[model samples]
Target: MIQPFIRVDGPAAALPEENVDTDIIYPARFLLITARLGLGPYAFHDRRFRADGTEVAEFVLNRPEWREAPILVAGANFGSGSSREQAVWALLGRGIRCVIAPSFGEIFQANCYRNGVLPITLPPAQVAALSAAAAAAHPFAVDLEAGTVTVAGRPPIPFSVDLERRLALLNGWDETATLLNAYGADIGTFEERHRRHQPWLFEGENDA
Candidate 1:
């Protein structure tokens, strides 16, 4: 996942109320071990598409206007359910940059960060206003640096993110990235010392 703090380049729209889970975002059948190819099409499997395998035209994502949505303005406790990183991957693959809601599931929120998606939380009024703007417009932009979400004529609405996650997303970092940076030199030194102390660990120069 690439961690670049970008201006969210489209309108933000709140999802329908409540309990939007991982399975809704990405179904279990698609969770096979295959690499992430083609997951974007199945992004919101059962919601955007019907049980008969047809498009649900009335769904927010099914609407042509929302095809390029970059920020999701969702209700409280969004992304709740089984811990599946694939849900976050699907959202990212489909070009969603950030999600705004009153709250998010802890696991889902962590997955979002790991996958390089920014999750923003705002009050209920702000969420409603943003969703309304998205319904009325095409592309709204959220400037991460400025901490503002701007639509055509509305006041630039402010938003907030957790400090640690914000820094990680802005820098395109996950736990591994943080660890590597923090301990790279020390780890390298330790490896060298270990090799010297335990000669039997290496059988020959070929092993080195």
Candidate 2:
């Protein structure tokens, strides 16, 4: 199950590169990975490490101050490309709960919601400000309930998320769970109607 995402308070990192796709987030070679928990090392694998497996000291995340950062300030069109949920898994594996950007791949943003990660879309200037704040190695606050991001030396930056999505993040409910919680009665009504109209479909369902 996804963890409740009321707020996240911690250091943040910056990735100013635009158009960083799913393959860049979680390389294609590791597509064999099926589990969600251990993909952290694979997030930005190529950019974060050398071919010989040594850490790329210059990469934002590899630096001592930003390593293990939980919030990421990214460039435009982040997570563009194939609809790979694994990409989100990779960030989650690395302990990243939030990514702030100007724009994102639609499917990737949806995947982020389903997996309990918040993808905050802000104007380019605000994102740049956050990225600069991130570079200072200071902690940032991402409050889902308040719909704001708190960076040092500035007013809380406001954001907007759909109502259903906001509740899903706060309550840690996956898509199916959220839908059921919202429409369980309606679904039951339909099922009852179906059973009445097509008794043959339920003929053996009640048998022990």
Candidate 3:
């Protein structure tokens, strides 16, 4: 099971560029990497590295302090263009558990939640404030229960998540887990009803 996301206590970073696509997040060439682990080095490969494979020090993530930041405050449409789950994996590889942005690609946002990442959609102004805070390398605390993000020396910023997704994150439940938890007994009852109506379907089983 994925770790429950009650809270995240760690440093944060900012990437203020708009419309960063999934391929940019995890370059298409590296898609051969089916494994979700060890994708940190490839996250924003072209943006963070040169043709010869040296680090691009100018990139915020390549900087020493922001390298391990677990929270990212990004610009509008942070993850757009494709339905690549690997993009979220790459972010996870960088220890990023939460991403704050004004908006995101629908598929990428859903992928984040399913993969144990929190994609917080805040107002543009709020996102900018968080970005500023991240630029200062302030540690952040995201309390899922409280629905707020707290940065050092600042008042808690409120955000909203879908109740279902929120519950899944808090309980560490994926889609299947959530469904089974919510309807396992109902499903059992329905199966019994179906078996009674069609005994032949359960001929080998103890339908009696």
Q: RMSD, each candidate, Å? A: 5.1, 3.8, 4.6
Clashing pairs in 2: none
Strongest candidate by TM-score: 2
TM-score between model 1 and native: 0.82
* Positional deviation of residue 169's Cα in model 3 after best superposition, in angstroms: 0.5
Q: Please report, in order, the local distance difference test score of every candidate based on alpha carbons.
A: 0.79, 0.91, 0.90
lDDT of 3 at 168: 86
lDDT (Cα, tens digit) per residue for candidate 3, span 96-115? 99999999998999999998
* Model 2 spans with C-alpha error above 4 angstroms: 184-208
Which tens-of-lDDT digit does each residue in 27-129 have in candidate 1?
9998984776456887888888878998988888777778777788888888898898888888988888788887898899988887778888788887787
| Model 2, total clashes | 0
lDDT of 1 at 195: 82
Shift in Å, residue 137, candidate 1 = 2.5
Least well predicted 10-residue stretch by lDDT in candidate 1: 5-14
Give the better candidate number (1 or 2) by TM-score.
2
Q: Tens digits of per-residue lDDT for model 2 on 1-208?
A: 8998999999999898799999899889999877878888899999988999898899999998888889999999999998989999999999999999999999999999989999999999999988988988867999999999998666898999999899889999878966788899999899889989998998867554
